[model samples]
Structures are given as structure tokens and as C-alpha cells.
Target: MSLDVTSPPVLSDVEELVPSRYAVRIGEIDVLVISDGVLPLPTKMLGHNVDQRARAAWLNDMFLPPDAFDWALNTVVVRNGRQTILIDTGLGMDPALNLPRAGQLVKRLKAAGIDLGSVTDVVLTHMHMDHVGGLIVDGVKEQLRPDLKIHVAVAEVKFWESPDFSRVDMPPGFPDALRAAAKHFRKEYESQLQLFDEEYEVVPGVIVTRTGGHTPGHSVVRVASGKDRLMFAGDAVFAVGFEHPEWHNGFEHDPEEAVRVRVRLLRELAETGALLAATHMPFPSVGHVAIEGDVFRWVPVFWDY
Candidate 1:
């Protein structure tokens, strides 16, 4: 065998790797962290008051690209013996905004052994495109379940439905997208719409609470069984949102109010030591935020591989 050094080395076949979808239990409720995909966000777009030099330095220190950051779009599924509840619908079937990297929620849900039609309820954290986009595909409703009920904050519905929404100047396609989503929500899911004004139980164990300012009705879903708890914070925080809770991002409808909501929530989460999952924190974006003096730090859940 030593004399066979003349033989060429063989190559192995290429392997395609995908991001892992994870499941963690919040007491008796089964929670599955599903991946929709990612959006490469510019750091500048993330914060209006973020110091350029400091942000760049932090990104460099973290070995991240100075110009861009990969924002993860994570959605959650909560299952009990009888009910299947979806936290947020990831970017749906829209072609214009559906980048190749995104629009994978349906496939990933199936991969996770969840039937599309088995989803009994969809809780829209807010009416943002990424959250509501997956509700409709190709101008037709992406029926998760024929009898599926849809829940949204009352303020959120009113915000997008108002004629004044059309009058307000927004980015070229943004207003149009909002109009389209509102139309679909009103027309297709009208009877299915369950509007809430404040914290209310969607079912016995799952609840929705308004966390506004990211939008008029931006909210979070809290699922608890026994003493275990997990909060699905939709766009409530980004990768750096917890670290720099004061920095205002462009995506927020009201930067000042957004900061206020974040600060109060961070403090409460810090005190309770409850687990958190955000849409743009990181894949399987589950963790806890620890309070350190005046600022909070992200403590990612350790993967026990």
C-alpha cells in the first residue's frame, strides 16, 4: 500500500447544507423554530442614530461585514394536543419582494412535519410585508387551513385600512403592498379576522400582547404552559436591537416610541428571565436578554449538540 503513492486522490460528492430548524419545549407546549430565509440588511438602514464609526467597529470586532448584516426571518409554530398555532407567516408568495433566499416557510413547515392545512390559526404580529406577505401568494390566499382563523391587532387593521394610509407618502411599492395585503385580509379573511386591542389569550395557553411602535400594532405572542414560557417577539428586536436598545431603526414606524417599548420590555424580560425568539435575531433566534446596568446583553441559548 505504501508503494501505491502514484494513485490520484479521490474527491467526495458535494453536499448542500441548509439551516437547521429547531424545536424547544415551553413547558407542555411544543414550539418549533422554522426558517423562512434571510434578508441582507444594510447596517445604515438598521439605525438612524447609530454612530457610523462605532457600528462599523462593532461589526468588525464581531467578524461581520461592515456594510451588511444578515437578518434572519424566523417564525414559530406552537402545538397543543388539539390546536396548532402559527406565530407569524413569513414572507409569502410575492414575486417582487421574494428573494431567492426567502419564501421557504411553506417548504420548511412541511419539512418540520407540519401540514399546511393543519394550521388552525395564524397570528399576525403586525401587518408588515414580511409577516403578512406569506398570507397571500400570486394574488390568491395561501390557505394554511380552509377554516384557519386570522388574528391581528385592531390598531394594525385600522392603520392599513384607513384611506389616510394611501395619502401618507411612503416608499414607492410599500404603500401598494400594504394596500394589497389589507385588501386580501379584508376580503378573504374577513370572517376569520379576530381583532384584539390589548393583551388577550388566543387560546388557553397562547396570548398576544401589543408591543407597538415598530408599527402601530406591532405585537408579541407569549406561550406558557405550567411555569415554562417563551415570547415570540416579531421584529421587536433585530441582531443589534437588544445590544443597542436605544438605537432607532429605519423599519420602525415611530423610532422614539419603538425605543420606549423595547426598553420597558427588555427590563421586564430581564427580570422574568423568560426565553425569547425574535424574527431577525439569528436562526433559531431563541435566547434571553440579561440586564447589565443600564444596557441589556443578548444571551443566546447554548446548542447541545
Candidate 2:
């Protein structure tokens, strides 16, 4: 069943096409955030905190337009010793989503001198369409990595696999493909799926920590090599606004819990002085947390790429 490329799949025009840089080294581990494209969301999706008037003010201050928000889709690749692991697959070849190059992750992986078959594991923070879309290629029998172990949070697996989600009021104007994607998540990727509880170590230096609330079983991975530590914060913080550490994204399943987790994580990152590689902050989304006058800011690292 090859993914149809001619027609718009479900979530069209949301994935980006601009090619971006690919690799960063953190201590002994090498990290890469590959571009799966970008999504253009209405500025209102940012949040309701800013009224239309405040929205205009904020956009003007940023020197950006007040109408829409362009957010990047980043898929992380972590390498240690002979092991290569990917966290989250980007939007797949979903024509409805308007992503022609949705399944370029494998291509990018190859460009990085890595092979999909060599990947030991693929950890998903949650089962959201964007995050898991690349796991399986449309119309293709084999997944992006046929041999790799696929891991997801137990709670997240349960949520996506359950029929109850249909009862919840979805976001306004949610796409039909997204709804269908949620329904078929389990049926499509159950063969290699491995569910974990709160915390578990996938490798000696790579640990999966529970940071739910965003999606019931949302989790983050911490990579430690020697004295250096870095966290792959997947959708925990979307943009620079997360710099506040108290603000939560509107799409979060449980906003209150999301904020609590964000605060605690930011505090921990600050205290540990660990590097943070955000999936959606910006291109080459690697940075550090800095506390200033009771507010936290994301200090993006300078990449020579």
C-alpha cells in the first residue's frame, strides 16, 4: 500500500519543505534533529492569553506577522557506541497533510552515515500523528526501521488504542486524517511496539523519564555522557514562549499538568546545567535553560553547521 503522493492526505500543508542542518555532538553522544518539514498554524493556536490586540502587539514586538505561526517538525537521532536511536518520526507521506517529503527521515538518516536497519530502538513520546507518522511508510510493508524495537509509553498506547477518544471533544476543525490516524495507531504499529511504565533505561547512558500530562504518557529522554547531560524535550515546550516555563501549549491534553511538568523540568535543567534539545523550538533546536529574575529563558547553543 504505497502512500498516495498526488492527493492531499489528511493534514495538508502543515509539514514544511525547507531543508535544514542535521547534526550536533553532545559530549560522547551525537544528536541530530532532522527536518520533516513545518506546519503553519494560525497565530491563535499559540494561545488565548493574548487577545487579538495583544496578539498584534506580540507579533510586532517579534517583528513577525500576526496572522500565522510557522513551526518546524524535528525528529531526533541519538548515537552512542554502536547504537543509533530515533525519537519521534515526523509527518509521513500524507498528501492530505500537504507534505510531499514527509518520509525523508530515512534519507536524512542515510545522509548522516547511519542505516535504519542499524537503529536499535525508536522511542515515541506519544502517539500523536505527527510524532508517529513516519514510523510506517504508506503502502510499504516494512516500517522505516523493520528491525528496530519500537517503544511508547504504556498510557499513551492505551489512549491511542482505545475507542474512548472519539467521545472527547476534539479541537475545533481537527482534520479527518488526524482522527483516522488516532484510530489506526495500534492496528498499524502493534507488531514492534514495546510499552514502558514511568522510567526505564534504553541504553547505559540513555534513560526515558516519565513526563506525562501532555498526552497521558508523554515522556522525555535524558542522555548522559561523563559529566555532560542533555534532555530531548519532545513537544514539552513548543516555542520561545516556553521560556516562561509556566506557560502551556493550547493543544496539550492536560494543560495544568503540562505546566507543572514544564516548571519542574526547567528547574532541573537549570540546576544540572544540562543542554536541552527541543523538538519544536526552532531549527537545530538545542539549548540551555537560564533563570533570570524569576523567569526562565532558553539560551540556544551556537551551532557551526
Candidate 3:
């Protein structure tokens, strides 16, 4: 029989042709990077402070479109044999926001053999809708254990009570949508909220530390075991952030302070040579940070098939 080279390869469920989850061992701990799907956003959102020409140049250099780009939505699962920890939930289907592609976290997690009930701890980077929206999806709360602990910075909950959006430069309806989503999440999960002051250890090797700046309660998770270290850097670092740590992302509530946080985190990563992953980096976002002159570089890890 002749081979059909042009035909697409057969998949188990036919749900997706491309891979949606990647697994790696961080020494004794097991780490998984799951795709929540992509969000198409304007290039200007990357850095509104920089001139359009500069943004255009960078996008071109990367062989991307000039007008917009798809921001990768990655959520991570960490298992230390004792607890199943979820770091940041991805965006759920929000009809009001018209983002249909996002909110794939629930289904994708199931495909990866993880059940909502099995997730004992949730370490939130902040109270942003994309980071917590998946937990508030219809019927999601009912499936989760009643005692599920959601770890978030104490300042995150208070900020949404009377959020100040004066400094952010989001799209026309984003500020309103963000405020409502955060409010709804808090109301739905109030009983499960595990508020932390600055730093908290989730498990034997996984610890979360507040970085502030992106949001007052923005945080990052560090996992270390047997000389292996990886940072789940939430929104503190982005695709462009590695090269232009000074540029202000439009979503940042305090852009100037966000810049400082990015610089500090990047510097630390370069010095430590730890693996780096962020919410909006490309799928399987694990990588290492390197310093090049005055700027930093992202060296993505090679995928092992």
C-alpha cells in the first residue's frame, strides 16, 4: 500500500492536532505546562510607551505581524507527590469579552489526566480575570472540592474591592470587564481564599513570593528540588519583557513599577540560571534567561520527544 503523505496524522480524540500539554520533571517534582489557548491582542499592548516604530521593528525582527499577535495562555500543574498545585487558572469563556478561544483550561486539564477535584491548592499570581476566571466558570466550583485552598496575596483581594484603573491603558471595555470578573471570582470563592502576606510555601519544594508592581499583589512561584529550579513568573515577565525590560505593558496598573519588577526578576533569573515560564509566553514556555550586554535573552528549552 502506498503511504498518504499529505493527509494529517490520526489523533485519539481529534480534539486538536497540535500538542496542548507538555510534561517535565523538575528533579523530584513533576511539572506540566498546559495551554489554555491563545488570545489575539494588539501589538501596542506590549508596550504603549515605546514609539510605534520601535514596536513595529521588534515584531518584524521576530517575523510576526505588525498589527497584532496571539498571546499564549499557559497554566501550570505541579505535583510534589503530596499535593497537586495549580498555578494560575486560564481565562474561561467570557461572552461579554468576546474571547472564545481562551478559557480552554478546564477541558485541557482533563485531557492531561487532571481532575478539578484533585487540585488541592491554587496559587494565583494576582486577581486578574485571566488568572482566576477559569475557577469561576459555571459548574466549575461545584466540581472542585469544597475545601480547595486558593492562595493569593492579601492585597489582591482588597484591590478589587475598590480597584483603581486610572493608570491602566486597556481597550475600551477591558477595565469594566476586569473589575466585574474580579468581583465575581472573589464572591464565588470567598470561603476558599488562602490569603498570604508576602511569601508562602505551598509544598515541600514549591514556594510563592509576592513581587508587586504588575498588580499590588502580583506574585511568582518558585520550585526547587535537587538542584533544579524553575520560576512560574505570572505577569511579571512577558515575551517582549526579556529584551525591553523598561517598556511598559499596557495592562500594567502601575507601568513604571512593573518595569522595575521585570528588570529585577530578569536579572535574578540570569544570575541563577533557573528555568523560566510565564502566562503569556509561547506554549511549553519553559526556558532559561541569559544576559546579553545590557539586555536579557530568552533561551527556550529543547523539547524532548
Candidate 4:
């Protein structure tokens, strides 16, 4: 059940694409892992503070391209009794973004046999484009499930609303585009949007924890049913974190604080042996963290049939 960091799972030959949706159980609750698609991130954008040569060596060790890496997009649907909540919405199909292969969440959800109408709540981990883009369909910004109540962290909204947020230095028009997208979603669903702070139970069995660092109000959702615990760590740590927990990523707003959060939470997760699901790990990104010596390693869970 545990694999070392140096040796990861490998696929041989040209295997047919696996189902975009996968089902797993956390105690009595049913969790459906839905894929949106993959994002090709330039390697230079990662490990901002790490030496380029060292980073390249690490990437090569994983049998990955040293120039760019593929980040899998995954979202989780938790169903328990009458409550059906989504952890995060994936990137929506948008041709303008030029990500031709990255926005198939709608199709993936359907393949998972999830009735969009049955979803009563959407708990957002953050407001980044990839995480919130799926809220709008057909260029219309609204709740995916017409009657669903949307939940977001209170600090997340406050952070995005500040003028400073818009002034933050980013590539050319990225800041403007980010603010625009966030503004549209907030305005479109202002009526149904619910904001929360502190560790609170959002649903009967799901608890949302404020673990900000990547963004001002980034969070993690924990689902507890029976005696099992599954943590949905939204952008808290990527695959590279296993080998370099202190590596600062370019996407983070507060680099130092991000490292603190990643190291602390990853250590705790490893000690407690809890199941983890993240947005940017490989598809159906479910795994467990392991502490080897003084660093952390990722032990991806074998897909349950």
C-alpha cells in the first residue's frame, strides 16, 4: 500500500484512456472523482526558488519532461444521504483560453452518473480560474445546479475585492483577467453565495478548514463518515512537494506562509495516515502521504475497482 518517493507508478505500452470518472468510498460516504482535463504547466513556473538544474534532475528522475509537466484536473463529489456537495468545480469548456484539452468536466460528470440537479451544494476551495471556471456554462455565470447553494471562504472574497488584488504584478494582463473572471462569478451568484470562516461543518459529514497560503483564503475540505477521513487539499501541495516541501511555487501569493502550511499539514496528514485528494495531482488524485526521514513522500492509492 506504500511506495517510495523515488519509485512511482508507471504505465506500460499505449493503454486506452481510463474512464474520466472514478468512484471510491470514505467510510459510508460515496466519493466520485471527476476529471476536467490536464493542464500543461511550464517547468520553469514551478519550484520558483529551486535551482533550475536541480529541478530538471528531479523531473527527469520521475520520467517526466524537464521543460513542462502535466497537471491533472480533478474535482470531488461527496454524497451522503440527502446531501450532495462538490468540493471544487473544474475548468469549464472555453475555447478562448486556448486550452483545447482541459475542459471536459461536464462530460466527465455525466460519465460518473451524477445528476447535476441532485447537487445541492458547491463548496469552493478558492477562486482561481481553474477551480471556479466551471461555474459558468455556455458563457453564462450561474450555479451549475440551478438550486444549489455555493460556499466560499469569507476571506477569499475580501481578498479579491481589494484594489490591491488588482494591482498585484503579474504577467501583462493576467491580473486584470483574474479579477474580471472573479468579478463576474461573484456578481452572477451573489444571491446564493455563502461565506464561512473557522473550522465549520458545511454539511452533515463534511468539514471545511481554512488552510490559506496559496491564496488569501484557500481551504481544505475534510469528509468524515464513520471512522474514515478524506482530505480534499485544494492547491495546498503539488506532486513536487513530496520531494521539496519548501519549494515556492509561482502561483502562490505568500511563498513563506505557503511553505509553512504545506510542511505542517503534510506532516500531520502523514502521521495520521489519512486519505488525500488534491486538484493538481494525477487524475483521480487520491493518495496518502508518508514521512521518510525528515521529508514527506506521496503514496498514491491504488484505484479501487
Best candidate, TM-score-wise?
3
Worst 10 residues of 3 by lDDT: 7-16
Candidate 1 lDDT by residue in tens digits, 1-305: 47767765663332116654888888888989888888666677567576799788778777888887777888999998788988887877556544677767877776777887888888999987778767675533564566888889998888777634422334346556666766775776788888899887888889999888788888999888999888888987877776788877767777888889888878888999889898988889889989889878989999745
lDDT of 4 by residue, 233-255 (tens): 98998988888988877678887
Best of the two (2, 3) by lDDT: 3
Every model's TM-score: 0.88, 0.84, 0.96, 0.89
Worst ten in a row by lDDT for model 2? 162-171
Instruction: Point out where model 4 deviates above 4 Å.
Output: 1-16, 139-146, 163-173
Candidate maximizing lDDT? 3
Model 2 scores what on Cα lDDT?
Answer: 0.72
lDDT of 3 by residue, 24-89 (tens): 889999999999999888999999999999999999999999998999999999998879999999
- At residue 14, candidate 2 shows an lDDT of 32
Residue runs of model 3 more than 4 Å from their true location after superposition: 1-14
